[model samples]
Target: MDLIADILLAAGALGAGIYCLVLGRRLNRFNDLEKGVGGAVAVLSAQVDDLTKTLSSAQNTAAGSAQTLTDLTQRAEEMSRKLEFQMASLHDIPDTPAREATATPAAPVSAQTTSEPMFVRHRAAEAHQ
Candidate 1:
């Protein structure tokens, strides 16, 4: 009976050792960096870091664009105000063709220049008015 008990105990120990060896190999595969959960975690972490940098750069670019647009808007408003003032002054003046004709008397011509006769140009303009 003693011999049988010892043999049984040895067999149990051998079975336990085999089970432990198999479990250790499975655990090593689960933790492998190249083809396991560890590899997936590493890839995900790198992607997250890259996304964070991209988001930061995008925000900076937007802020710069906003500042530039604000400056352009202010400059446009100033130019518009100046143009409005000029238009108002023009509205106050009379639209008189005779006043323009008489303001500076025509210079006496010797009738030698043939490029264009001044009186003919003046007549055509007066016809338009």
Candidate 2:
């Protein structure tokens, strides 16, 4: 009976040793820096770093564009205000050049004749003679 117990204990020890060896090998493979979970993690870490830099650069570009847009908006508003003022001033003028040239019935005919161009004045003098 003692000999049988000793044989059983030896067999269990051998089996345990074999299982431990296989587990150790699998653990080594899982932690390998190349072609394993460790390698995948390293690749992911590098990608995250690259994405972080790209995001920062994009944010900077967007901020610059926003500032430019604000400046342009202010300039456009100023120009619109100036145009409105100019339009109002044009409205204040009493008469256009065309209306002034035609002359109203209220003015003396002689005033219209005197205001004529030099060529017209000479032509009138010749006609009178």
lDDT (0 to 1) per candidate: 0.88, 0.88
In Å, residue 121's CA in model 1 sits off its true spot by: 30
Best by TM-score: 2
Count of clashing pairs, candidate 1 = 0
- Name every residue pair that clashes in candidate 1: none
Model 1, 1-129: lDDT tens digits are 999999999999999999999999998898888998888888999999999999999999999999999999999999999999999999976566877758976545555455765554467877988
TM-score for each model: 0.58, 0.63
Error of 2 at 13 (Å): 4.2
Cα-based lDDT at residue 5, candidate 1: 96
RMSD versus native structure for model 1: 11.2
